[model samples]
Target: MRNFLVSSLILGSSLVALNTNAAGTDSTTFQVKITVNESCKFTNAQDVNFDAIDRSTGKQNTATGQLDITCTLGTPYKIALNGNGKMSNASNSGSTIAYNLFQDAQYSQAWDKSNTLANTGSGNSQALTVYAKLTGENNVEAGNYLDTVTATVTY
Candidate 1:
């Protein structure tokens, strides 16, 4: 009985030692990081079309279109239009018309490569209206006229 009690006490102590070892604490670190990059995109932009333009009216023909742009917040950008004023007819090579684009409703702020239009980004979609005026002084042959003006944004 004495030997058995001693063996039992030794086993109980071993079990207690194992339990203490199992309750031991371990520690590590967890980390997180984030990064944001500058970016911009053109959401939408329709062609500025003046359908069936009158060549002999001698009055300014006007049209308006919109361009949607989205970019990172607080970004500064300048928008410019680049293309010749001449709108050549696809069917009739000799027929052509002249036109100009403005940034303001007053037709004063011309949107051209030389004079870039400025605006700030709101981190959301922004609608930019383009005011276009066709010069009525053109005396070219009558036909379907078309022209493509590239809208460029410089940051």
Candidate 2:
């Protein structure tokens, strides 16, 4: 009975040392693989920023353009807002802008020779101008006529 028990113990110890589960997970085959994907990129067509360098400001103007205004009693005030956007594609590239003005309003007359701003690649400057007039009575009040100009750029 002692011999049989000793033989059974040896058989159980050999089975535990073989350990087939450990060998199954060993990385001997080394089947290495990699997957990659690439997508396209585009040049962003964003608009340019516009600003005027001047003394007359909201706190401002043009290819040195001027917003000249004239007003008189019993006569409509005639005013014009003028400016030019002469940005290059290299110095300031791929950007476009426009201009608008408060031409004709209460007690006023207005005008604009160049209305829309077109995108040009010829290195030529784009000019913009708007006209306005204001009608006044004999007692037309006068001071510093001011307005707000907005320039919006999008990317």
Candidate 3:
């Protein structure tokens, strides 16, 4: 009877060892990623104020204004201006004035959609100067005139 009991205990211990050795391990792998979208924005608000005008001069008067722009590094961009030269006076609905915007002080490159001035970003703020001139004789009238143009940045 003792021998049989010992033999049974040995068999149970061997079975437990076999089951422990039979157990296995496993692992899994996954992927990670991110997408960085390009972005840009105007850093400042600007207005091309052509102060008081002398309509009697019969000559073009000029004014200057600047805006700051910031964009992602290595981003290519162009600034375009769109507006009609005919500016209307608030007090006199019938009164209007003509003007033009340019990309240089010489008033050569018209800031029109067709021009599409091109530039690149260096991860820093850049100043863009807008030149404006009231061409031809200020033949509109002797009243205050105003015009607004939208400055668009394309990347």
Candidate 4:
């Protein structure tokens, strides 16, 4: 009887030790995180072409162009135009014609470095129209007059 009791106590202790090791559990937590930065880019910029302007007509020459931009969703952005606001003659650099850029067809809301167009991004391409006009007084020597305007986007 004494040997059987000793054997039972040892077996019970072994089983308890096994259960304590198997049933015990511990846990910890780690972090999962990410950050999205505001971003913007110009997808396309079309040239503002004033084709065959007849200076003799004594009328304001107008042209329309476009700029396509894509940006992060819900990001606010501003677009500014930077240029000399004049189209220089290729043959004669001294001979130039002054022009104006506007945000509207009515020649209102001048678009320049100071005055910018503001909007919210939709994570897709957005089209913005650029209106350009040359007054009728630009009677200078005009043989392939050209100008470059940079569009800067700020988010």
Candidates' lDDT values, in order? 0.84, 0.31, 0.82, 0.89
Say which prediction, candidate 1 or candidate 3, comes out ahead on lDDT. Answer: 1
TM-score for each predicted model, relative to the true structure: 0.80, 0.21, 0.73, 0.80
Task: Give lDDT tens digits, candidate 4, residues 1-155.
Answer: 99999999999999999998899678999999999999999999999998686655666789999999999999999999998888888999887877888889888899989999999999999999999998536777858888889899999
Candidate 2 TM-score over all chains jointly: 0.21
Residue pairs of candidate 3 with colliding backbone atoms = none
List ranges where model 1 is wrong by over 4 Å: 1-18
**What is the RMSD, in Å, between candidate 1 and the native fold over all Cα?**
3.1
User: How far off is residue 129 in model 3, in Å?
Assistant: 0.1
**Candidate 2 lDDT, 1-155, residue by residue in tens:** 99999999999888887775456653455577985332212112222233432322332121112221222222222222233422222333333222333333331323333332222222222232333222222121222223343332111
| Model 4, runs deviating above 4 Å | 1-23
Tell me which of candidates 1 and 4 scores higher on lDDT. Answer: 4
Instruction: Write down the lDDT that model 3 would get.
Output: 0.82
Candidates 1 and 2, the one with greater TM-score? 1
Off by over 4 Å in 2: 1-121, 135-139, 153-155
Q: What is the lDDT of residue 14 in candidate 1?
A: 100
Task: Please give the distance, in angstroms, between residue 2's alpha carbon in candidate 1 and its true position after superposition.
Answer: 15
Candidates 2 and 3 compared by lDDT, better number: 3
- Which candidate leads in lDDT? 4
Off by over 4 Å in 3: 1-34
TM-score of 1: 0.80
